[model samples]
Target: MDWLNYHHLLYFWVVAHEGSVSRASEVMHVTPATVSIQIRELEKALGVRLFRKAGRGLVLTEMGEAVYRYASEIFAMGRELIDMVRGRPLGQPLLFRVGIKDVMPKVVAYKLIEPTLNMPEQVRLVCREGDFSGLVADLAVHRLDVVLSDTPLDPNLKVRAFSHLLGESEVVILGERKLAQRLKENFPDSLDRAPWLLPTDNNVLRRSLDLWFADHNFHPVIRGEFEDSAMLKIAGKAGVGVFAVAAAIRSEVETMYGVELIGKIPSIKERFYAISAERKLKHPGVVAISEAARKRLQ
Candidate 1:
């Protein structure tokens, strides 16, 4: 491979950002033809086409996306370097991009990320909520600094990342005040034939709860199953049915949803994890989150 020309890379990066050579030329104060030539030279040096045409605009190819990711990081670091050399106090906060799995309880996610806000170095948090697989893909591509999930990353996935076990919490059952008062009488036995809101069967928590139910021989009447934890809690809050949450955030759940605690199931615990591209965490914000979560959950 030939030595990389940073000038060519800068042109390519600008064109990617602008989505067209003409717009990139306007930003860089160069002719459109100049930008095109520079990008073509970069493509030739890298031995791969970077952009593809779509609706009179350009979109990045798979390899192009990968290159763009690197180019972004490189330019970001370069800007930071210039700031340091100029002795300019960096008032701008560092960005901490994270992904939260959709099935994760919103309150739990907030607790895990809350410590980063108090760090000595300022940090701006950006959260992306999606399915675990999609979040894992973004983490693999370096788009997300970390991912918060109830379950650890599956080894079956080919992504190169490490799952750091933040900690685990016992599951706590909850219900509206009146329903909880009624069920609190019999404790575990009261769960039988009780109206219950539940997570969809595909969720890890739901699967674990299913085993616990089977072992205890409890047959609760299912009111509804939800993919969103917040919606399930909302239904539970309206006296739709009882639901469960992580004991670590039990107080917040009750306060936020105006629900009462039915009981805690110590036997059934929910684990939390932080998945990142690096085995050894380097980001200060990520480290703060991991540390805080372990302490809180423990």
Candidate 2:
């Protein structure tokens, strides 16, 4: 076999892991054309077809699957080597790529790590805010050094509870003035009458809320559904309907919009875990950030 190009191998690995050229392109911050070309070049050099088109996307062929298995191991070893060299005092500053769920307010995340960002030693802190599933998947693939998320890690991945108590709060924000007044007048009883803006039915938070409602026999009039907190907040502010949100995030919601929590429901709190590949714990940079975030957030 000809000497393999590391960059091409990386592109191939990402495409194989992501299972789609478009998704790999997003993670690599490159164009789909670039990824396709590189993968083609890699296949040409190896004298084997690595992928086959399936509908609009490419699926790894038998040879591609075999190569990907080895490629993953090779990349993992390369990362270990880089980490070992970077750990030396005279070597380059360690690069720590962390991922956080989009649900987490960026401002709060920044505030938590403000101190470490100014450290004298050259440390590269790259933070990517994304959905929980995508972030977790990336962490499992060694694309992220660490991930701060409310969701549980996959069975294949290793996770530790950095923050034992993930404190969250839920309150209904009434959009209409008449509805707000009625809610206030009726107090807790009015909760069942107002139209509610809820997270998606599959969201853990939403599930918790449903359970609470079931236990209390309080059925809310759900008017809208949102997958993103930002959108829920906006809808509430626009008087479209009532919305539920974390209490700690109330300040953020109030600052940007004119909305008030109607009645306090039981706070929805969960455990937040610091997730990473188990082998990644050997890296000093990964350990440092995990400890730092655990201390700050927990």
Candidate 3:
């Protein structure tokens, strides 16, 4: 098959709009036969009839209508590209798709993304949360613009990604008011023999908390184990037991869950990261998030 020619398509486009070859030729500074032959060549290349007789004028065939739609968009985008490069605004909303690891706290995720959502320019945000490795894979293939994770990108994964350390903060033990008041004093010693709601064993926070407890020789009765941070906080509000969480959103947790802060463990820190295909951030939303987190978190 011959390669498609835009000249042929352009001639067909002009003839379609003008409704006849003679009218198109007059405007195009070509003979009617020249315009007709080019339209025939375009139809042959595409393997579809572009037009049919309707009274004295020409009307697009079904296949021609489909081609016309695509041609129209192609030309429109070309114009838009030119205008954009020339410093003209197209007013098109930017799309930002972010993937969050399932282990990440929703509140923390929201804090990280809030700045991007509040941008002056119009933007559409799409958030997906699930497996960390899978999310990293999506980012590698450009399926995701960025990814937020409680842990850094795994070094073992073959996928290429750069992890930007947003910040790290100490972990805080929280409980319902009644329980917190009882265990508030004597701090570390008070936590000994206390009823505790713990994160699932596999969790990074749980591992850190385990080490911290072992170091301090403070052992608590593990009442319940939760994989979901929000559920753990809910159980904390129900007085199930004290649970540990990152201290970055201290005020938000207090206000939203109405839980009491038992104490802050400065030694135990949880790091947050933004993973991307590029080392230097390019997406406007991602840049906003990384910059704002540097100032707001930690």
Top-scoring candidate (TM-score)? 1
Stronger candidate by TM-score (1 vs 2): 1
Locate the minimum summed-lDDT window of 10 residues in model 2. Answer: 158-167
Worst 10 residues of 3 by lDDT: 79-88
Better of 2 and 3 by lDDT: 3
Model 2 pairs in collision: none
The TM-score of predicted model 1 comes to 0.72
Top candidate when judged by lDDT against the true structure: 1
lDDT of each: 0.87, 0.67, 0.83
Best-to-worst TM-score order: 1, 3, 2
| Ten contiguous residues with the weakest lDDT in model 1 | 80-89
Q: Could you tell me every candidate's TM-score relative to the true structure?
A: 0.72, 0.59, 0.70
Candidate 1 lDDT over residue span 138-191, tens digit each:
675457889999898899664567899999999999999999999999899999
lDDT of 2 by residue, 1-298 (tens): 5598888988998887777999999988999999989988998889999999999888889998888878877876776687677664566775678787776544345534454465666677888988776787776566787776656665533222122222233443444455566677676666775678887875666887788778768888887887676777677777777766555455656677677657666555533555655544664554554556555442
